[model samples]
Target: MVEAARALFVREGYHATTLTAVADRAEVGHRTVYVRFGTKAALLRHVVDVAVAGDTAERAVAERDWYRAALTGRTLADRIEALAEGTAGLMERAADLFEVVLQAQATEPELAEAFQAGRADTRGLLRRFVESARTDGLLAETTDPAWQEETVALAGQAETYLLLRRTTGWAPEQYGAWLRRTLTHVLAAPLR
Candidate 1:
């Protein structure tokens, strides 16, 4: 049901997608869709949650292995690769849905709230990462943590990913490489 809604939401914009359509796609009763997920906004949020987490597991993204690798990979470059690859994997799975959220946020309060909440979650995780990296001398010691966090956030953002994908026609793997190269060059790590 979540997958069906995700497909419909991405193929057809959020406003254009309906509970009935989701029900039909999922081959479930119309009431089942409503009873399962009260509103379209709620359903969309659920879909995003599943995509972001890569599953409906009740675990936070910070608990995920890839995210952990970003924090504790063998080397600075390895950590950077983990960050790039993890972000690329996430965007590949949900960038379209994120674009859908971006479009729908303008008029939908629920979606706007959800979108902001998601951003906050990303920033919070990034803040911790930058702090840890700085402490470990993986990032420039003199650089501001806020700057580092925001820079990484901007690079890993859906808007940036979508824009680059649209203009350069780069595939996900290509984007991941670009991210790795950009991070390695743009963020100078201090000598360990």
Candidate 2:
């Protein structure tokens, strides 16, 4: 039932979707849905959780290449490139579910918190990546761990906007090159 509601929610959006619609999609009676979930809000939360979990899982799996490349001295530039490209691929692949979550957050403040949690998780992951770079002496000694992660997060947001809006013809490699060069100035250790 939850799965059916999620599909309908994605297809028609939250505001337009109703319990009846969800029930129809699930091939269950409307009374059953109401009895099981109690209210539309509960079902909405379930749908959002399910979608967020899926997105997180997919992104984590896709990022294995990034961890491998980074650990292998493949070049921060190259690894960063893989990161951006992998993110874009994930976003495009999960566009429907993402769109549903996006729309839900527009009207539901509670859903916004869930979305922020997702962002925080991404930031935490990037912070760890930055810390690893620092420990490896790849980044400058003066760089703050927090700031490094923030910069990466900002760079990622820009890359996402570009990819989603088709703002340019950048292939992932092109974007990654730009990011690495930018970061080199921002975080690279000064030459002795």
- Give the per-residue lDDT of model 2 (tens digit) for 116-143: 7766766666566666666776666662
What TM-scores do the predictions have? Answer: 0.91, 0.61
Pairs with steric clashes in candidate 1:
none
Taking every candidate in turn, the Cα RMSD to the unseen true structure, in Å, is 2.3, 5.1
Question: Which ten-residue region of model 2 has the weakest summed lDDT?
Answer: 53-62
Per-candidate local distance difference test: 0.85, 0.63
Q: Tens-digit lDDT track for model 1 on 1-192? A: 998999999999998999999999999999999998999999999999899888889998899998898888767788888888888898889888999999899888999998888777887776676666767877765435566677777777677888998999988889999989877765675423
Which stretches of model 1 miss by more than 4 angstroms?
143-145, 189-192
Winner by lDDT: 1
What TM-score would you give candidate 1 relative to the actual structure? 0.91
